[model samples]
Target chain A: MNGNGKKKRIGVFVCHCGVNIAGVVDVERVAKALEGYSGVSFSTHYIYMCSEPGQNMILETIREEKLDSIIVAACSPTLHEKTFQSVIELAGLNPYQVEIANIREQDSWVHSDKEKATLKAIKIVKSMVEKVLQNESLEPIRVGVTRRALVIGAGISGIQSALDIADHGYEVLLVEKNPSIGGHMIQLSETFPTLDCSQCIMTPKMVEASRHPNIRILTYHEVESISGYVGNFKVKIRKKPRFVDPDKCTMCADCEDVCPQIVSDEFNMGLSFRKAIYLPFPQAVPGTYTLDIENCLGLLPIRCGKCKEVCEPDAINYDDQETVFEEEVGAVVVSTGYDLYDLNHLGEFGGEKYEDVINGLEFERILSASGPTGGEVRRPSDGKVPKNVVFIQCCGSRDPENHNPYCSKICCMYTSKHAMLYKHHVPDGNATVFYIDVRTGGKNFEEFYQRTIDEDQVLYVRGKVSKVYKEGDKIIVWGVDTLTGRKIEMEADLVVLAMSMVQTDGVNELLKKLRISSDANGWLSEAHPKLRPVESLNAGFYLAGCAHGPKDIPETVSQASAAVAKVGDLFAQEQLLHEPTVVPVDEDLCSGCGICVTICPYSARELDKEKGVVKVNEVLCEGCGACAAACPSGAAQQRNQTDDQIFSMVRAILRG
Target chain B: MRIRNREKPFGIEKPVTARGQIVIIEDRCKGCGFCIEYCPNDVLRLSDKYNSKGYHPPYVAHEEECVDCGFCQMNCPDFAIFSVEVESGEREPAPAESVKR
Candidate 1:
């Protein structure tokens, strides 16, 4: 099998994997069959091929028999390819000198007939042996890692991740889109289950993050672009103009008082009014005031300089322009959180058009102690407490036809919390909740939902609110209770729609910048659903909070901590040794067609204009084989999974 | 199911001779009480004194009973509190550790 016409010395090791593979495939028979193969100088079967003794047997045979190539017939290559690769490398053989044949997940588990299974294992082993005969040595690419982390979004998840990374003595740049550091968590009244005040727990972390020497806060900024590989990421951030000096503007209301222009306060969900110059919230991390350039008359040619004149610190600057800056970091944590589904599109709900009908976030603002009503449950239609409050769950969720089919994980529990908070505000008030199903899948979440029904005396109806229309002074909700098989009509002063959670804005643009894939619904896809849940397929990037999926505060915090730990593990090392499983382009064979450059998702390929060929950035190549498949010429080829190796296996499989 | 009480039983402060000291990194403690919850011998409690960040850091309430297991340090997310072991037989003044904060 050697190219020099000398017989190749090869070894084959079969694994029992206890009963997983041994139960179906006859391991000794397969070993005996492979021992007679043309180039196999040594063959053996072990109880566990990945075990220390099993690996030792292969290493000993390699040294004793002078074996140049090795084939392992075990579980899928994904399960133990790296383990076997390291074993071969330790035995002074090239890592690429080894090949794995799928005998368990591909053969034994799929076939019931013992005869066919054993026969199939032999063919798979023969294919790998042929492939291993042509294997060449490969060395891993090492790159230096910057021990700094950039966390996008200053929500609870991002705040937690940034703080955790900073605690590990790594510098962190926490960037937020809004004028303030706190994200949606700052607007929440009280979290579910424990009922701990969200701001009470959140603001302390925000303040600590602001004061921490290792952490830097970047409010009112967005990630413009991201480039480079895992250990060295170059990020461009766009700093939106605040029109006020962040350092000089104290949390004083002087400018706010003097400003003649008034605008809807976004932090209050547009239910409250604030001057053109205002802070996002009272407990904002930086404690700085931002002037709304769009609404401020002073910024226009009208020459209204009232706010500038009254500013004690002279913070007002109408000429403030947006600035873009670049940063270099080793890793990034995306905790972009989530935005509520627009209930205005759901015409049946009569939300946004009607004053009394509101979304969950607006209700959260109403329940907040620092809100416009001062924690009072006052209806927006009239500044009076509503006696009858109704909540509808799954408004735009789990509806495949017109809305998102996936469950908005937090709606059920939060709706229950909303109902409970309503009852707490008005003891005599009647609280009713209409839900498709109650999904409380978190620690103490179910108990919290039950407490609202049992202890708080909130009525739970298992039904979908078909229609909510304003009739006279009350919003009439019509639906049918499925459990009782009867139609029910309820009149309510206030209606709260638990809107479905959607991915944060500018996700597609951010995804393009980060060079990562997202699911159809726009949630960031993890590397693996189970093993690598916190990490993205692209190295150095991590996902946290609702950005990955819908999750509660505790889960979000835990995930953020997990992401920080991952970043810390990466930062602990001086440099990263990337897998050598990248495709290399044979420049002579490449046509300079630029097909590979366009096909590569990682942007690892480029057409060399001078040479009239294509070049591959080995460090950036992810070895997805997309370019290899798209190449008209067989120039673009992966190192381990080359066209020849794959074709050899395919031919062997199809031989019989 | 009812609303589960999030807090564990608050430990009582008992007088003890000092065997070890748990240094409370004041600003780092978010008062999560993970250390108190994981302490095998119940040697720590949320301090009455507040840090600049307003979080009650975990303090050595029963220093004599402490075995220096380091479970508190291992479980702390913020790495705010860590146990510093002293000589097994070392005897120190009583109640001085309480007022040190």
Candidate 2:
């Protein structure tokens, strides 16, 4: 309320988050130094500014002193920026007038010397104080939402989110690149710990997703591009050529029975074969077959309409081209999931050269009820039950040099599951496992590992397998016995390498388009490691399952539900608030150079030919500052952090 | 010096019972002091004097009465130390009567 024009009174509060700051610096000394700074109506120090007492003190001070502007020095703004902003707002202060100085992470946590840390904290406070003195009142920008969500990838995580969102009475568009929605889960035979059948638990969810009234399952499609921010995104989907009419197709297998070509079946982990036009599995969500255009006989147009003549429904349409459709969605959940690490990278293990060696996923399929040999534990090379089976743990995981340096977190349990399955299938067969460490820390997970050892009589060796080579029909494994200080060797009929889990290839591109950051391991970076594990740096975008990191079934499903809760909260609002400090274009300095257009990750900019100017779409801009830095003419300026503001701040820092 | 002789076996000469002197090369030592720390006789010590690299290398300050023990050479990380057990009777040839007897 600026009814009467007067100088605005501001208060600055600096906090030492316990020893997180005060252990290395003198907090009271720094606060005393800034007591008489200009425009600082009040200055104080607190132990923990984010606690209940600390927040109440701030609100009380703001009300009692009638302070206009607020400045805080605490931990990283990522931790408690919103808490203080809300506290000040409750005290009748504008939220936009708050500025934070990150003294804990930037100053105290990294420095050892007390004097240097204290001096750094003072400088940071001074800079933030300068910025707050020049601050002006701003209004929050509101955009209407479409109240619809788009879920990418039809894996278990995506399916769970779609189901949960649709159950909440909202529309969901679930898109999958494959013809079916089961993803890698459908390929697995059994889950770990409980030894439950994978299909027994997964097929029901697939059927529910297909029949849900609020869900639209779009298979054989991909998201081509995304524009606008959360609550107002315009998404374009590219539907690849299926050559079959989905609306008219019935649950008939005539087309697959008459197809002339056969290809390797990916659903079986490439252990079996499938026709050119066939369903991924009998339990595919859509319960229909998809024609592989690359290998379909009709695509060649030589002489293959045998299925059309025999079909009563006439669902085959050979002339259907690719179609592109656009939809407006309010929020997006990225659950693209993960891919298995390739073991061929470790050439010393004779990975690809040995026919008897396979990955854990392939072994899972072999143990599945609907597997190639009808759940028979047989060696692929000779078609005989293996006398001895050896499972090698940590093939690509935890090796800093050539593979992922993080523990996969699922291999230990899955390997134990594999041993139990082997014992169940072949009673006389011997099972052995070589591992560096067994990390079975989940609920009843240690008991599961113990059951395999004590009840099933599976041998556990404590060491890493150094070398593996093929010797005729057997694979010779060489390793060291660290407990006994002896080198040991064993010959086995089959070996399974427990591979690691890694992010999909297109994740980086998707993250860039969505304006989210990822950690060093390529997992989408969470807001905080412990506090907010399900949310990303970008609002309205939540992470689920292996897209964030490797996790087993229980952990993955819990996180998926957590993501659903977040999206539901976002959809409950009538309008969404976007940061007002986005980049803006200056029409007077028009040069339509188009450099900034190409640099924007969100495609939020366009050049207007009629006026010879660059225009920015306010809804699409995410304020990443990439385009502003690329603007050579200095025509593009970001709100609140304009070029003038940043330049002045830097100059004042250098002056000190 | 006193000496005791024993009967020889085949072409071997008579055995003599005499304490041996110990010598240490300071340049090759790494200051691990396995000998000084584990010596049964407490005869060896690490010298205060340092070498080119300024490390306090071990030395045998009293070499005359050493009962040669070879424990230092076994535990050095760099394999830089070794012991030479020289017979005390080598300085002067055994008396002719003792050798013949």
Candidate 3:
């Protein structure tokens, strides 16, 4: 290897990309313009350098001309940087010797004037040529992968991701903050459009995840902290105490029946009662009961062991303590899902003040077959069937001044589903929906909404509900009729608010721990909006479900599978090869000052106590150069841009 | 104020009188052009002259053509315009004195 050589022969290849570049900028002219540049041994143009035929031309030229370095002027390097890097490597050249200049996205697409676009392409090509001349041959850095994955939150999205990843022959650690695996899906009576029972479809998947050999399901747990980079992450999970031995428990209801302490059942949206030792739902995965220690008689000062006395298996234990375990994983997939908007914030609707008002999730519980009233269309207050029910759409969505400005995307369909469900249950019941607009653009979604209105005879009112007030036995709904141009009022026994979806709590702390990016709305950001929707800027980490954005069941499941595919591709290789363009710390010049350590988003740098200097972890360094710029002593130098390289590049541009 | 005499030789409907002033505050207008777009009577127009922010503000080009419908004020996001209706054939001083008493 000529570590610091002077006599270098460079080859330049310009791609037309099928009129993507050549339609406006003349590719042949660019090659000709750069023909006589210093040390340029060969110059050529191809219709598409990324295609098979074009790659062959580049490989052949490198061999024939004995090109020491190469440059490709084409689309943004983000699109085909890896493709060209591999092409040069196959030709027996260092992959780091290749540099790409963007001309399509930055030039032709943005500029209408052909002459200006051509000139801009020429300048970009010239800068890349200058940089390639001084390029040093370098070796790719290799890091060992742990080959295990972590799935956060045991919701439907997390369950799907864990199962898919486990089926790919990799170990997965599935962590959940609740006592059991079926999340919000288990609370719903039925799904939309198809009217399929929610538990009928969700229970099987939960059981499979629990029984999968490669998956270790950890319920009633949360990740406390995460350290190290991808391929070597040490995660600490905190398991809360359930006061019950999970392994020893049998599918017996004797313990729950004897527990006299009763609390509001969250599974029924707090509209029903539950024992201290009770399952979240009758169909909960693993089918075990959790002893709520907070409310349990044994944990309280009163000391009651009624549940233990009744259990034949002696599964109830009051002495259990919280446990912490650490696991190492190569990749992590965050699928924390979403929480429904709180209706109490809308004071105009008499939200929590009225007993008849409830949010969508709570309404789902009331409609469930196992709910308090056994799936009867009765009011929660008096247990009497109501003559009329009113559903409010966009209660906390699409209101820029007081609520979320963005459309929740699922409200319109779910509200229509709720109305249709009510009409099906009570034949003579009157159902009315107050909405600003109806968006049903999915497959067979529009037909479902139409059938609800035309066949089911649910009233569709076009306007916003101004206020809701309690009137002794019934809630009064006041709204303007945009169609009739008059104020209308209705007395309904029940009101359902279609709430918005928001990010799960403590997401910011997780983002900081993982060094991942989030958009303005706090959903995880992807590498590219259209191309790499499942991948993040950091390698070995992927996103899925509502953590990425507001998506329905079909879209969320598809994206979860996509993330599994990406992780599988990464684990296929024994060792991961990283770009040599990472930042390096000069041991001689570094002073134990840890300025770069704090500014590094990835925590790639640390002060070595033995050496009394900063040490850079190559695996964690993404080469963003943020730490390098923060270095006060100028000791942290990013590869490919050593001080000498940047100085020379600046001089070349200024001279030209 | 003199009302139309019923016994006149040539009897005709008395001309309708005007009302209180309908004021338009120019500075608060955002020039969204909603007033001109929604006006049914075609009494409002976006002025060619620019405001302090260099946007064409809405102006009542035909002041006498206003119908006092209040449609323009309701549609305006910035609340730049409003209308008032007073009884015909009443002097401004007389009406002010009756309200004060």
DockQ, all candidates in order: 0.01, 0.00, 0.00
What clash pairs does model 3 have?
Answer: none
Winner by lDDT: 1
Better of 1 and 2 by lDDT: 1
TM-score of chain B in each prediction: 0.64, 0.54, 0.60
In angstroms, how far off is A331's CA in candidate 3?
2.4
RMSD after CA superposition, every candidate: 21.2, 27.2, 22.9
Q: What is candidate 3's lDDT per residue for A1-656, written digit by digit as tens?
A: 13566677889999999998899887888888778787778899999999999999999999999997889999998789889989999999988889998888988778878887787777777777777776777888898889999999887889999999999999999998888887777778888778889888899999899899999998889998888776778999998988777778886877765554445566666565555678887667666789877655344323446577778888877778898989999999988888777667799997577767878887786677877668877776666777799999998889989988878888888889889988888989999999999999788889999999999999999999999998878799999879888898999999999988877778767886777888766778999999899998878789989888888777888999999998898888898887778888899889988999998877888899899999888877888898777788889988886666667666655654
lDDT of 1 at B15: 15
Number of clashes found in candidate 1: 0
Please give the range of 10 consecutive residues that has the lowest summed lDDT in model 2 chain A: A297-306
Provide chain B's TM-score, model 3: 0.60
What's the lDDT for candidate 1? 0.83
For model 3, the DockQ equals 0.00
lDDT of 1 by residue, A1-656 (tens): 65566778889999999988998999999999888677898999999989889989988989999998888999998889889988988889888788888899999888889888988899989888878776766788889999999999989999999999999999999998888888898899998888899899999999999999999999988889989999899999999999888889877787765554444567877666555678888888788898777665434323456577788888878788999999999999999999888766689987467778888998998898888788888987666899999999998899999899999888999999999999999999999999888988877888888899889999999998888888889899999899999999899999988989889878767786787789999899999999999999889999999999888888999999999889988999987998788888887788899988998988998888999999888888878889999999999888767888789878877883
lDDT of 2 by residue, A146-199 (tens): 788999888899999999999999999999998999878887888877777889
